[model samples]
Target: MIKNHLSQVFYCFIITIILVFNSCKDKINSENQTKTEQTEVSKTVYASSVIPFFDQWKLILGDGSNAGIATEFENKDFFYTQNDGKDNWVVFKSPNGGDTHGTSNNTRTELAQTKKWYPKTANDKLSATLKVMNVSATGDATVAASHSVVVGQIHSADAFENEPLKIFYKKYPGHTKGSVFWHYEINTAGDDNAKRWDYSSAVWGNDFSVVGSDVSTFPEEPKEGIELGEEFSYQVVVKDGIMNLTFTSPNHETKTFTKNLLLSEYTTKSDIPEQTKKLFFPIGQDGVERSEAYAGEGCFFKLGCYNQTNGKSPEVNKNWCSGAETHGGDIQKQYADGNYAEVWFKTGSISVSDTAVSNDGYFAKND
Candidate 1:
């Protein structure tokens, strides 16, 4: 009887052990399956994706008489020109005293035109390449000065009423020597009239003196001389009231700049009744005049835009004050507007070998 009881006990113990081991095996298998499924899903979602946006436009500026009658137009098909005859005239986006002579009729003209085309989606990103070719210029050259290329909004009257983002480059005989200069002016039409904030050589000069009651409320200028070039890729991204500007070189080196101004800042104070919401890209301070003194010769350039948005995102509000708030969203909208973001090319008797555009990029939106 005792032997029989011991056998029964042994068998029961073995059975219990077997059951526990099988249960554990099942649990392990289930866990592994779940992990594998998750990995597959992640791979499926993150595969390379294509985002569509408008590509850059090719523009031509020519002298009317010798280049003949150059007719420039911008539409869905292409941004182009037909030259008449004269080839001695130089093309300019920003003309200074000496360089003005080369411009037809000594008047700054828009060689291309664009219509408004907003994206259907919000929070999208866009990018493009700006190629500035040195066409030709004439006469007495001095120190080559830098040229300014800008990307901003244009108001109803075609006036550069709003503060547009700008990039400045210096032109020398053989070397390109210039840095990006980013400037912002708040309450521009009010008691703060023309009170500007610059993040360029201003830091080097340490001068914040400007016309405004709250000139005392200015922030210290950030670092300047961030270099950019042909081999470098420049990109801007905007989402949910944030603006991120990035520059990547061929070697994969990247530098980023960011700023967050609030939407309320876009509003005008009761003191400035003339202020209105407008977007603009005026030739920056470093046009042909400055280049003549700095660059040994002059330069000519072109502007382009890439639009990538489906409109599912939020529409850009002109009243939004802070580009930081909209993330990269505002910059994306500017590109989608079908306008060539303003950029200056150099041509003439000067050399702008080392001129570079600034990385002062931004986005704007509310909430």
Candidate 2:
């Protein structure tokens, strides 16, 4: 009987030891797995991580939702991050017909800088390395703004609220290459908005005035223009009321332009260019810029895909209206049909003039 009791006690002790050891081992393994998952999550990249300057800007999505502080924000349909096997990119997408800004008829998934400054008081600069991934594929080819997207701008915040600069990328359907251009809208002298016009200049290929002859007929493709998915960079620096622009791309010539904001280039009726007369005159847009162009007015920077395509009747304004197929503002249907614009930015920054920059930094600093 004594031997039997001793053997039973021993067996019980051994079983308890085994159970405790297994429990401890399972707990350790679970802890290690949790740590690994935490590390992976911490290393994940977001749109804010790609563009650190989001702290200084607010976002407006294509669905009309606005975000003030978007430190780690993204929407799969409008603004999000993408990895192209090489590196991650921040994408801005918008459909042709959807929610729009109160002051405009276009839809956008864009960032607007929160800080506004006067050109004479501050030297603000915005730079970016980007590519136009896609644009509205279906539109009236004769419309100049059709099938185009504005990637960057310096928008006014004062009277009339005109845009001082709008960098545009336009590609026609069935064309392999696209054109890069910029437009400077004049600050109209009077209250009528109908008289305002934009003066456009081309960085690569034809300017905004080069449109198709008719709705279906297309123009010759720009021989040296940029293609879809091609990378390019631009810098806009406003120093002492003078605007300086620089555009650079791989395998293309670098272009630079300068404009004086304190002085007016179009103070009289005859100061209009031939391109503007031919493009805007028939539409009764013949206004001239004020003497002190954009001076003392508060302005902010905007970056993203400001889709220019709309569903308006082209007969009303052939130059501005696109009359694209909208499918009654259905976003998913528009996306499936390639009736949207998408722009991807690899890197970008907005800085004041006095900001220090490393010599080998990606953003090109204008001395």
- Stretches of candidate 1 exceeding 4 Å from the true structure: 1-124, 134-148, 151-160, 173-177, 187-192, 201-229, 263-367
lDDT score, candidate 1: 0.26
TM-score of each candidate structure, all chains considered together: 0.33, 0.86
Cα lDDT of model 1 by residue, 89-174, tens digit: 11222221111112111112222112221111114233433323221121111111112233221111111123222233322122
Q: For residue 183, give model 1's deviation from the true position in Å.
A: 3.5
Write down the TM-score for model 2. 0.86
Q: Count the backbone clashes (under 3 Å) in each candidate.
A: 79, 0
lDDT of 2 by residue, 1-367 (tens): 9999999999999999999999999999999999999997787777999888897777888876675556888788998888999989999999999878665778988887766777877688999999999999888989998989999999876677789899999999889999999999998886787799999999998899999888888889999899999999999999888899999999999999998877888999888899999999999899888899888787778899999998888888878889998889999999998999999999999985443222211111100
Error of 1 at 38 (Å): 59
Q: In model 2, what are the clashing residue pairs, if there are any? A: none
- Name the best candidate (by lDDT): 2
For all candidates in order, the CA lDDT equals: 0.26, 0.87
